[model samples]
Target: MGYYQIDCFKIHLTILRILGVWPTENPSPCYIYLSGLFVFIFTVLYVVIYTMNFYFLPQQLEIFAEELIFYFTNVGALSKALAFIFLRDKVKKMLEMLESDMFQSDNPEEIKLIQKAKEKSSFYWKITAGLSVSANTVNVFLPFVVHVVFNVKLEFPVCRYSFIPEQYEAIFLYPAYLYQSIGITSHMLYNVNIDTFLLGVMFLAMAQLDILDRKLRKVTDVCVHTNAPSGSIDKMIDDENAVAEIIKCIKHYDAVSEYCKLIQEAFSEILFVLFSSGSCKICMCLFRFTMPAETKYFVFLTLYTVVMTLQVMVPCWFGSRLIEKSSQITFSVYDCDWTPRCRRFKSNLRLLVERANRPITIRGGKMFLLSLATFTAIMNSSYSFFTLLRHMQSR
Candidate 1:
């Protein structure tokens, strides 16, 4: 398959384009205007408007938590969307690298590995997108259902534009609510799409590593004549053909390393915001417990907490796997029949092993390493914040 067939992400990238955040070198005026509109919506409406609303709200834990959840969630989406826009050139380079021959292979086994990784990525995209859109649909429409069927007062699924005097809320509620539904739906899709796309890149990178390991294991394989002496096995340890194969594998490893470096460069800020803000988001999610025990909002918050946790945890998990898989290449080389190999091959292999000795670490924004330990630290910080909030409430 071509570069592990990562073109499967084309559809999602197109979605981002429609969402007006996809970067273009010279977008048409219409597209530029569309992009500007989203920028205004995210900055002026969500972040700026919501923050002002939060500040004016009374110091109740429920109000702050509710507003904070939406605000923080919006921040995640906005930051990632903006990062993608500004880092467009880096993203283009990364995609070019992904599609380069360095990540491609003719071997059936390696092709299968690529296929599996692509399938897994597509599966995640479906699940995450479906869940995200479904959750947003419920948030927007469920309130209207309550108003219609049970005569409960209607509410906006987002900030109520506290700047608008409540006396006239009735006049604007319908149109304002319409804007909320559309804006939030767009934001939700962007959130899931960008996240899955990032993680999918990492997943595919790990798959390349898997193929690299397998190639290393077979790097010394050689064919021998049936009449050849058993002693000839030593000479065949690394034939010229085997040397060529090992070189290709070495290049594959290098490509994967470079691919990861590009990912780090493109997503450094995005990952930083994810891990750093994850705790506060989780803390706000936890504050849902402060709501009435029988409240349905509790269930929503519970699910939201899970989504946020997965958002942080999945990156760390993939990152740890990337480090593990890349590091194991050295051992794979050792496992092959390389002891009696030629001097040139041995020297090259030795250099590769030396480089692999230091496991490739994908740091989150040049800060914490993206591993389970980092995930745990983030969760701990979230719990600490939650605990501190509880104590404050008790006082």
Candidate 2:
């Protein structure tokens, strides 16, 4: 027999036979009638119990939202912190490069500062890397605990079974619970993927920053010394004024700043896309519409909490990225050897210096984007709240 057929036979012949309901032939008309009646009664009981419980005891649903909000917020914070730590070395090296030209490019002090910054950023980056994987795992699993709690409430009654006088309530009660339980579990899984994606992107950012910083450092190290290309050395411009030297060496630093900003902007854009897509929208709609009034209110409250958290989070994140990008520019310029004959080179370097300054503008752009996103989120929240209120009033 096929597996499904064998499973059906086993359930009917063994379990149903033991209970004395196994059919030897087609069920009689009386048996079919009774079965239909029982199913109908069970359906009625299920609907009544589910509707009553949902409309009355919204606290149960509120508890689930509260747990989810807490878990997700903490995960976001920890992931961000760990990501910062993992990129620390790159940040330090970039900073050193920016300050490299503060003294004579050929000076040992300038090289030493660069070296120290690289070492510091590297150590922190390693430490943060170790923490990020663990934090991500925790973020993925934390919501399962809440899922289990909701599932239990769905399956088990808070009151005594005897208190429910209807036979249908006893028969169909758990299935209604199963539906919401499944929804809760699905949402938790979705949250896990979101956290994992964020962490994965952060890991990539850390790795790319390391590679970029290493390349820039090598180039800066070469520029730190006074040896010009021979044979055509006379063709090369040289100058002593720090500003002129700065203008000359700005190109390489500008490249570093641009590369870093490019990575950050790309990552942010991906995050926004991921959060606003189809599945998130559908899930959010169900979460709002399926719950009763008080539960819906609590959902709005949770949204408010997320808003406040994001307000703090977005600004801090933008500030850190801005400062880091600016530091990379500073270190790149600092690595240049500003000498008396480098005047023409300095003029060519002006373009690069200007490029290095571009990240500050990019940083400002991010702040503007974040402000727009925040406004959108607020508008959505207000619309949802008012619509829900109108729904209640009409009812």
Best by TM-score: 1
lDDT of each: 0.81, 0.39
| Model 1 TM | 0.92
What tens digits encode model 2's per-residue C-alpha lDDT throughout 1-395? Answer: 12211121232133222222233346678765664453233333433444354333334543443333333333333233233234434433432333343211343544454344344444433443344334433433343455566653333312222234466774756553444333223233323332333333233333333333443344333343245564343324323333443433344344444444543553353343323331233233335445566764566556544544443344335435544655475355445443333445555555555654544422222433333344455446545754664576469
TM-score of every prediction relative to native: 0.92, 0.37
Q: Weakest 10 consecutive residues, lDDT, candidate 1? A: 222-231
Q: Which residue runs does candidate 2 get wrong by more than 4 Å? A: 1-173, 199-203, 206-220, 223-319, 340-348, 360-395
Cand. 2 TM to true fold: 0.37
Which portions of model 1 show Cα errors greater than 4 Å? 1-4, 23-26, 148-151, 222-239, 291-294
> Residue 103, candidate 1: how far off, in angstroms?
1.2
